[model samples]
Target: MDFKYVPTTCPYCGTGCSFNLVVVDGKVVGTAPFQRSPVNEGRVCPKGSYAHEFVNAPDRLKTPMIKKDGKFVEASWDEALDLVAEKFAQYKGEQSSVICCARASNEDNYALQKFGRCVMQTPNIDHCARLCHASTVAGLAQIFGSGAMTNSVSDLADTNCAFIIGSNNFEAHPLAGRRLMQAKKKGAKIIVCDPRRTPTAKQAHLHIQHYSGTDIALLNGMMQYIIQNGWENKDFIEKRTVGYEEFKKNVMQEKYSLENVSKITGVPVDDIKTACQWIHEAEKTTAVYTLGITQHTVGVDNVRSVGFLQMLTGNMGKPGTGVNPLRGQNNVQGACDMGALPNVFPGYQKVTDEAAVKKFEDAWGCKMPAKIGLTIPEMLDTFADEPEKLKCLYLMGENPIISDPDIAHVDKALKNIEFLVVQDIFLTETAEYADVVLPAVCYAEKDGTQTNTERRVQRWRKAQDGPGESKYDWQIIAELAAKMGMGDKFPWANASEVFDEMAALTPQYCGMNYERIEKEGLQWPCPTCDHPGTKVLHCETFAGMPDGKSVFAPIEHRPPAEQTDADYPFILTTGATIWHWPSGTMTRRSESLNRDCPTGWIEINEEDAAEMGIETGDIVTAYSRRGEVDVPARKTPDIKKGVMFMPFHFWECRANWITNTPYDPVSKTPEYKACAINVKKKEA
Candidate 1:
C-alpha cells in the first residue's frame, strides 16, 4: 500500500485552513492536519475534514454531456467543444456573459476572465462575489480605498474587543471563530449583534439582538452615544480621517437617538449603550460582519456604517482592529482579485481605464471591451426581460438557480436564455438547464492558489488524478479559446505559467510566485520579491484616498425593500448551516454532512409557533409575495419573534424562492436577509 500525505488549503470557507490529503495508492481517502499552516495551525472545521468525500462520490460527472431532444446524452470533448464554440461565436460583446467560479483556482478565474474579455470581446463577467461581498468591495473602496479585510485572521486573537455583527462566525466560519475564542480566553470582550441567539451570540459578553435591515440605525445610535459621552477618539478622527463634521451631524440627529434606534432595531437602549462602551473602552476593537450586513437593500450603507463606527473609534490601522468582512467561499477573494467582476480587470483595475485596457490588450495581443458589464442579478433580469440583448451565458461552477434571490424568477430567466453552458463536477440543479454540461476537476485534483478572507494567498497542491474525461477549468477554457482562434493568447503550459502571466499583469500579485508560497502562504500587497506580506492595511495612511486619510459617508437608515404587511406579517431571513455549505453541491454528497442535515427547516419563535398552532417538526408552509415553500418548523426561542430563519442549502425548500429581488443600488446585492412572509401549519 503506497501512502502519502499532501498538504493543501481547505476548499471550503474563506478561512483558508490547511490540511494534508491522505492519499493511498493514488487515491485521496482522508484528510490530516498540517501543523505549519499560518491560518488554522493544524486545525480544520468539519467541512474541511470531509472535503475529500465528494471528490470520488458515486454521481461525479465523468464525461461531457449535450442536451439532445430535451434530454442529456454523453458526448465526446470534440463534439461538445465544437458545438459550444460554434454557439458562442454567434454572440459577441454585450450579447454574451461569463460567470466564473469562486470555488475554482485563481489561475482558472484569471484565464476565464481573459477569455471573456479578449476572445468573447465582452465585459459581462462575474462570480459569486456579487451575491456575497459586492458591498464590501464597493463600500470599503469608497471609504478606505480598498475593499478587503484590513487585518489578518490571526489578528483576531490579539483584539481587546471584537464587535461581531451580521455574522455567526462560530457556525459560518469556524476557524475564524476559533480566533475570537482565543481572544475571549485572554479576557478580550466579545460583543455580538444579531437577531438570532446563535452559538456565537450565546458565547458573547453582550449580544445586541437587533432587527433585520436596521444595521444603519444601530450603528448610528452607537456612534451618537459615543460622541455624546465624549468617548470617541477625536484625535484619530481629526488626523486620520476626513468628512467628520458632516458624518457627526448626520449621526447626532434626534432620529438616531438611543430610544429611537431601540424602537427601530428591537434592541434595548441599555444594551446598545453597553456595546458602545465596551468598544470604546477596549484598546483594540475589530468590527466583524458577513452576509447579514451585505445582503440587504442598504448593503453598501451598512458596510460604510461599520467603517464609520471603526474609524470614529480610531480602530482603522492596528493589528487587532479594522472592518473584517469574512468571505463565504474558499476562493471568493481570489476570484475577485483575478478580475472576475464586470467593472474591473485583475487587481481591481477599472475596465474603462485606457491604460489598463491597453496593457492587457498588449499582453494578450487582442483589443478588449471598455464598457463595464452587468452583475449576476442584472444579467438574469436582462435575460428575462430582453433575452435578445443578452442571449448566451457561460456559467462555470455556479448554482444560481438555488443561490440567487427569487429563484422562481431565476428559473424563468434561465429558461429564456438562447444558450447556456455549465461547467462543474456534478450535474447541479442549474446545470440541468444547460445546453452543454462540461465535467471539471475539483480542488483535490488541481494545482493552483487561493486567496483567503484576510488577503492571504495560499497554494492548493494536487493530491490525486481527476475522474475520467474530467478536465481542469482553465484547460477547457483554453481549448475553447483555441477553437475560437485565440490559442496564441493562452499559451501557458501549466497552472504555474498561468500564475506567472497573471502576476505580471496584477500589481498586488506582481511579486507572487509558486516557489515563494510553496509552504506557508503569503498575504497580498506583497508587491516585491523580497517584501513580506501585509498583515494590516492603512497603518500610517489610507490607501483609498489621495490625501492619505479615510473618508466618512454620511448615511441614513433605510427600511428593508419589502416591509411586513398584514398579509405577510413576519420577516424571513436566509443563511447557511454548519453542516452543509452553500447550494449543497459538494457537502450534500458527503455522507456524514448529509446525514447530519438531511433536510431543510424553518426556525420560528416559540411564541409565533404557538400562536399559529405549529410545533417543532411540523410541516409549515411559508408564503411570500414572490413564492412559497413547505419546510419543517423548528420552534425555538433562539430566534426573535416576528422573524423566521431558513438555510438555503436544501433544494426541496429553497429559501431564495421567497427572498426579495430588490438589490442595493451600489453593490447590486439582493435583500436576502429581509423579506415579508406568512407561515402556517400545513394541513394533512
Candidate 2:
C-alpha cells in the first residue's frame, strides 16, 4: 500500500486554509490541517477537519446509472452520456435552466457555467449566491468598487474596533470566530447588534439585541450619534470618500431621528450612543456580517445601510477599517468571480452590457443572450404561476429540498421540470427524484481551486481515486458534450486545461494558471500575468461612481415578513449546526458527526418550555401555514424565549417545510431567518 499527502483548501466554509488528507494505501483515512498554513494557523473547525470521510462511504455512488422504469441501473459511461445527450440536446437553445453550486471547484464551476451558456444557450443560470448573498453582492457592489471583502481577515487583528450586525459568527464561520476572539484578546471593542444572543454576541464587549429586520434603523441611529459627537474621521472622509455633506444632511437631518430609531430598533438610546461612540472614536474600525444581513425583504438596503455607516466613519482604506461580508461557502466568492449569476458575466460584469457579452462571446465562440437570467427564487415564481416552465433541470452539488426557505413549494415547483439530471457523489434527497444520476467524484478525488470567504483562491488537491466506477465531473461533462456534438468545446484532457480556459475567459482569473496556483494560490483580480492579486479590493476607490464615492440610500426599519401570529405564536430561526454542513450531504455520512448530533429539534427556552408544556426530548409537532414536521423539543438557554432554532441538515424533517416563502424585493432571496410557527406536544 502506498500513500501521499496532498495539501489543499477545504470544500466547506471559506477559511481557505490548507490541509492534508491521510491517504493510506490509496484511500483517504482522515484529514489534518496544514500546521504551517497561515490562514487557519494550524487549526480547523470540527466540520473542516472531518468533512473528508464521505469520499469513500458505503452509500457513495459507485457507477454511472440511468433511470430505467423508475429504477437506477448501472451502465457504461458511453450509455449514460448518450442518455444525457438525448435529453439535454432536446432543450438546447430552449428556455432551460442550470443551477450551479458554490461547493464545486473552479474548473467544475467554469465548466458548468460554459455548459449552460454555450450548450444550453440560456443566460438563465445562477448559483447558490441567488440563495445566500445575491442581495449582499448587489448591496455592497453598489457602494464599493468591487463586491468582495474590503478588508482581509488579517485586518481583524490590526483593528481597534469591530461593528458586527445580523450574524452568529461563532457557529457559522468558527475560524473567523477565533480571530474575533483574538481581536478581543488584543483589547479590541466588539459591538454586536442582532436580535438573537449568538455565540459571537456573547463574546462581544457590548451586545445590542436589536429588533429583527431593523438593521437600517440601528445603522442610521449610529450615524446620527457620530455626527453629534463630531468623532468622524473628517480628514479621511473629505480626501478619499465623496458625497459626505449630502449624506450627512440626509442621515443627520432627517425626520427619522435617534428617538425614532430607538423605537424601531427596540434598543435604548444610551446603548446606541455607546456603540456609535466606539465606532466613531476608534482609530481603525471594521464592520462585518453574514446571511442575517442579506436574507431579507430589504436585504439590498440593509447592506447599503452598513456600507453607508462605514464610509461615513472613514473605514475604507487603512488597515482594520472597511466593510467585510463574511462569505458562507468555500468557493462562493469564486463562483461569483466566474459569473455564475444570471445578470452578470464572469468577473461581475453585466450581461446586458454589450462590451461584457461581446468579450464572453468572442472567448467562447458563441453569441450570448442580451437579457439577464432568472434567480432560483424568480424561477420558483415562474414555476408557481407561469406556463412555459423550466424544463430539463440539471442540478449539480446542491440540495434545495432541504436548503430552500419553503419546503412545500420546492416539492411542487420541482415537478414542473420535464427532465431532471442530478450529478453528485451521494444520492442526495434532491437526487432521489433524478431521471439520470451521474456518479461524479468528490472533492478529495478531484483537484482544482476553491475561493474562500475573503476571495482567496487556493489549491484543492486530489488525494485518492474515485471508488468503484465513479469518474471525474469533467469527464462526465465532456462525454455528454461529445455525445451531443459539442465535444470540441471541451478539448481538454484534464482539469488543469479546464482551469487554463477559465482563466483565459474570466478576466479576474486571467493571470492565474495551474502552475502559479500550485506554487501559491492566486486570489481573483489577479487580472494579468504578473499581478500579485488583490488582497483587499477598492483600496483606492469604490465602484459605480467615476470618482469612487459611496452612495447613501434612504432607508427605514420594517418588521420581519412573517412575525409571530396568534395561530403560530413563536418565532422560528433556522441555522446550521457545527457538525452539519448544508443538508448534511457530507456531514451525515460521518459516524462521529452523526453520533455527535442527529435529527432536528426545536430549541425552547426553559420558561417557554414550561409555558408550552414541553419538556426535554418531548416529540412535538412544529407546524405552519406552509407545512409541518414532527421533532423532539430541546430546552436550551442558547436561544431567547419566543424564538426557536432548528438545524437544516436533515431531509426527513425538512426545515424549510415550515419556513415562510417571503422573498426580498431587491435581492430576491427568501427570508429564512424570521418565520411564524407553533410547536406543541405530539399526540400519542
Candidate 3:
C-alpha cells in the first residue's frame, strides 16, 4: 500500500481524534488514528474508521446541476450562481433572513455569513447550531464567561468524579466514554444521570434515572443537598467564584427539595441524595453533557444550572473537574469559536458593537448590519407561520428538512422557498426540491484546517483533485460573489488566501498561519506569531468571564413542547445514530456503513413494547400531532417506559415530521425531547 500518511483531524465527533489520511496512489483509502498522539491512542470508531469510503463513492455529485422539468440537468456553474445571486439580491436587506445549517467548513460558514450581511444586506444569518448547541452556548455564556466546554476530554481522566447528565457518551463519543471508564478504574466515581441505562451507565458506579427535561431541578436538588450538608469547597468559592449567596437563596430553597426533584426527574429521592453525597465527597468533579440537555426549551438554563452546581462545589479550573460539553460534530466548537453564530462575530465578539463591526467592515470594504440575525427555527417560522418573507434560501451544507424540528413545517418552508440552492456532495433529502444544486467537494478532496472539540486547528490535505467536474465550496463561493457583481470584491486564488483573510479579520485566529500549523495543529487565541496556540482555556483567566463572576439564572421547569395526552400517550425524542451524518447525505452512500447499520429503527423499552403489543422487529406506526412515520421497533431496555428514542438519520422514517416545533423563546431551539406520540402495530 504505497500511500502518503497525511495527519488531519477526524471530521466526525468533536472529540477531534487526530488521524492520518491513508492516501493509496493519490486515492484516499482509509483513516488511521495517530498512535503517538495521546488522545484516542490510535483508536477509532465505526464512523471515524471508515470516513474515507464516502470520498470515492460512485453516488457523489460530480457537476453543477439545475432542477429542470422535474429532473436534475447538468448546467454550468454560472447558471446556478446567477440564480442564487439574483434571488438573494431581490431579498437583500434586514428583512431577508438567512439561516445556515449543518455541514460546511469554517471558511464556507464565514462566506455564508458575509454573503448574508454584506451582499444580501441583512444581519439575518444563523446556523444549524440553533438545533444542536445554541442553548449550550447561550447557557454557558450566561454562567461562565464563554459558551464552549470549560475542560478538555483529557481532563476527564484526572477527575475524582464525573457528573455526566443527559449524555450517552459511550455511544456518541466512544473514545471519550472509554476515558470515563478509565476514570472509574482510577477510583473516579461515574455518575450517569439519564432516563435510560445506556452503555455509559451500565458500568457506572452510580446511575440516576432522571426524567427528560427536568435536568435543572435534578441538579438543583443535588446542590440543595450539598449546601445543607455544608459540603462545598469554601476556599475555592471564596478565591475563584462569586454569587454563592444568591444561588443558595434561589435554587437551594424549597422548590429543589429532594422529594420535589425526585418527582420532577423521576429519580428516587435516595438516588438524588446519593449523587449529591458522591459529588460532595469527590475532590474534583467534571460535568459532561450533549444534546440531551440542549434540545429542550430550557436548554440554556439547564446548562446554567449545571455550571451553578459546579461552581457551588468549586469543581472548575482544576484538572479533571470542569463543565465539559461533548460537542456533536468535529468542528462545532471551532465553528462557534470562529464566530459562526449570528449575534457574535468570530472569537465570540459581539457583532452589534461598532468596533467589532468596523473591524469586519474595514476588512471586507462593506458595511455590516448593526442588528442581530434570525436563528434557523426563526427562519422556518417566517416562511410558514409569518408570510412570504422567506422566499429564497441558499443552503450550503445542511439538511434541515429531515433534521429540523417539526419536519413537516421545515418541508413547507422548503416548498415556499421560491429559489432554493443546495450545495453538497450528494443529493440530500433537503436537496430533493431545489431550484439548483451545486456539486461541492467533500473534506478528503480539499485542503483546509478544521478545529476540533479540543480547540485544535489541524490541516486537511487534498488527497485527490476533486472528483470529476466538482469544485471546492470556497472556490464556488468566490465565483458566486464575482458573478453577482462582487467579482472585484472577492478575488481569491485558493482557500489558503481565503482562510488567511478570515483569520486576520477574526480576533481568535489573529496570529495563526499555514506555517504555524505546518507540522502540529495549533489551538486558537494564539494572539501573535511568537505564541503557541492555547491548549486549555481559563488556565489563568476566562474570556470576559461573567464580571469574573458566574450568573445564576434560576429557571422554573417547563414541560416539553408537546405533552403526552389521551390521544398521544408515549413520548418520542429524536437523536443521531453512530452510522449516519446529518440527513444521511454521505452515510447512506458508504457501502460499509450501510452494511453495518443500513436502516433506521425506533428504540422502545421492553415493558412499553409488551404493553403496546409490539415485538422486536415489528414495524409500527409512530404518530404525533404534527405527522406520522412507520418504522420497525427494536424493543430494548435502553429507553424509559413511557418514552422512545428514534434516530433521525433516514428519510423513510421522518422523525422530525412527528416532532414538535415549539421552541425555547431565548435560543429558539425546538424541544425535540418530549413530544407525545402513540405506537401502533402496522397491519400486515
Tens digit of per-residue lDDT, candidate 2, span 227-251? 7878777866776666677767767
TM-score of each: 0.99, 0.96, 0.96
- Candidate numbers sorted by TM-score from highest down: 1, 3, 2
lDDT of 1 by residue, 1-684 (tens): 999999999988999999999999999999999999888999988898898999899888999999999999999999999999999999979899999999999999999999999988888999999998999999999999999999999999999999999998999999999999999999999999988999999999998898989999999999999999999999999999999999999999999999999999999899999998899889999999999999999999899999999999999899999999999999999999999999999999999999998888898899988989999999999999999899999999999999999988999999999999999999999999999999999999999999999999999999999999999999999999999988988998899999999998988898889999887888988899887889999999997689989998689999999989999999998888888899999999999899888999999999999999999999989999999999999999999999899999999999988998999998899999999999988998
RMSD of each: 0.7, 1.9, 1.8
Q: What overall lDDT goes with each candidate model?
A: 0.94, 0.79, 0.78
Once fitted onto the true fold, the runs of candidate 1 whose alpha carbons sit more than 4 angstroms away are: none
The pairs that clash in candidate 1 are 145-544
Q: Where is the poorest 10-residue window by lDDT in model 2? A: 381-390
Clashes of each: 1, 3, 4
Give the clash count for model 3.
Answer: 4
Residue-level lDDT of model 3, residues 1-684, one tens digit each, is 677887766777777776788888888888877785556777877777888888888878887888888898988777777777777677757557655533566776666677767777776677777887888888887767777777666768888899999888887888888788889889998899887777888878888987677787888888888888998778767766666776677776787898888877788999888888888889888889988888888888878888878878888777788888888877677667656667987777788898888887887888778877777877787877765666666677788887887877877777877777888888887888888988888888777777766666777777776787888877787788887787665767877776787888766687887788776667776778888876566655555674575555556666676778999988787777777766777777778998988888888999989888899899999988888889999999878888888888898887887888887777787898778888899989
**Best candidate according to TM-score:** 1
Lowest-lDDT window of 10 residues in candidate 1?
544-553
